[model samples]
Target: MEGEHSHKPADIKARLAAGPKASYLRDWVYGGIDGTVTTFAVVAGAIGAEFSTQVLLVLGAANLFADGFSMAAANYTATRAEREDYRRLLEQERRHIRFFPDGERQEIRQIFQNKGFQGEELETLVSLITERKDVWIDTMLAEEYGRSNTQSDPVRSAGATFAAFGLCGALPLAPFVLSIPEAPSAATGLTALVFFAIGSVRSRFSTRSWLRCGLETFAIGLTAAGVAFLAGDLLTRLF
Candidate 1:
């Protein structure tokens, strides 16, 4: 009776471990917020200075491409360097595990002991973990050195950032791009929408609700724009 209902294939019955979640939320949010903020800052600045729509388009487009690409490239390099550092540290941990295993065993015992294991249970767990070299290595990397097994994808991260940067960052220029009348006012409204949208996307990764995050992002963006706009007005008036 226990075996009679078993119909699943062997591979189907066993679930494999999936790849770790990519650590790109920071890059995504940063790129998204920064891209849009900088582009909008330029637009607001141009508007304050009473520049023609042609001047707004020229400045906004230049800041959009130049700044967005630069941020994406920087994220890629920084993320790649982080992965390389992790790899190097992992190799060092492996060597330590190999050459000084007794020391590592003591360290493992201490780690679990700190977790409240004692007597037979502590010894048993240490034995079970060290039985597999990979598990042992992972334990040392996590327990002793405070690291995780996830490998970051720099190219993927960079692409996400760049895509966000390009899509949302260029929003402020949309009115001018389309040659809409009263372009500055329309662009401000559009900028608010863009801020809320990016913030909603950001909520998926963080614990914050979409509404709170959206409002907060919107506020920060508008504040930045106001400052930029004010600075432009001051400079224009002074000159």
Candidate 2:
């Protein structure tokens, strides 16, 4: 019975350690949407300027590659920096334990007291937590470290984000790349349809209604297209 009881906390900790896949998926979806929206607007604007198809394609391709790499690199560097900061904080905490044991114990006592454990129970809990080096450190981490489970692999997160964004960005422009000489309008219509579908699909990440997601995405895409088209037309007039 004692053994079984002791294992319960370990089991709970194991369950807590499990990664939240939905959160990662949501991040990827958002990244993709951002990339797609920005790129689509730029491409549409360029096309509206009555530039040759070659020029539009070149611009779109450049945007896709540059933006994807930039997002990925930024994610990688940021995650790595955060991880390093966390380690450094942990090391400082360990040093505090070595050099200021009394102060650390007092802090732990206060922490437990604040949690409603008082008198002997609080003393026992504090003693148990401080008895082991690992347990002691973990308590300090929870109470002081303020660390939470987040994406730890900078490279993996970067790769996933870049791939998701690049794929989404390429979808609308694909029609332009594949268009035959006689069917430009058809290609544009097809691209719009794809944009709507991507938006609807992305809504799943937000756990929102498909209709709302679709409409929101449509609004964004339409707004970008409208603004770019007007700008392009204005530029043509000026030049």
* Highest TM-score scorer: 1
User: Which pairs clash (backbone N, Cα, C closer than 3 Å) in model 1?
Assistant: none
lDDT per model, in order? Answer: 0.83, 0.73
Best by lDDT: 1
lDDT per residue (tens digit) for residues 1-239 in model 1: 43233446754455333434757777777888788878888887787788888887889888878888888899889989988888998899789888999998999999999999999999999999998989998998888768787867989888888988888888889888888898878888988898888788788767889999899998987787677778777887898
State the number of backbone clashes in model 1. 0
lDDT of 2 at 84: 88
Model 1 residue 136 CA deviation in Å: 1.5
Residue 150 in model 1: lDDT:
85
Indicate the residue-level lDDT of 155 in model 2. Answer: 77
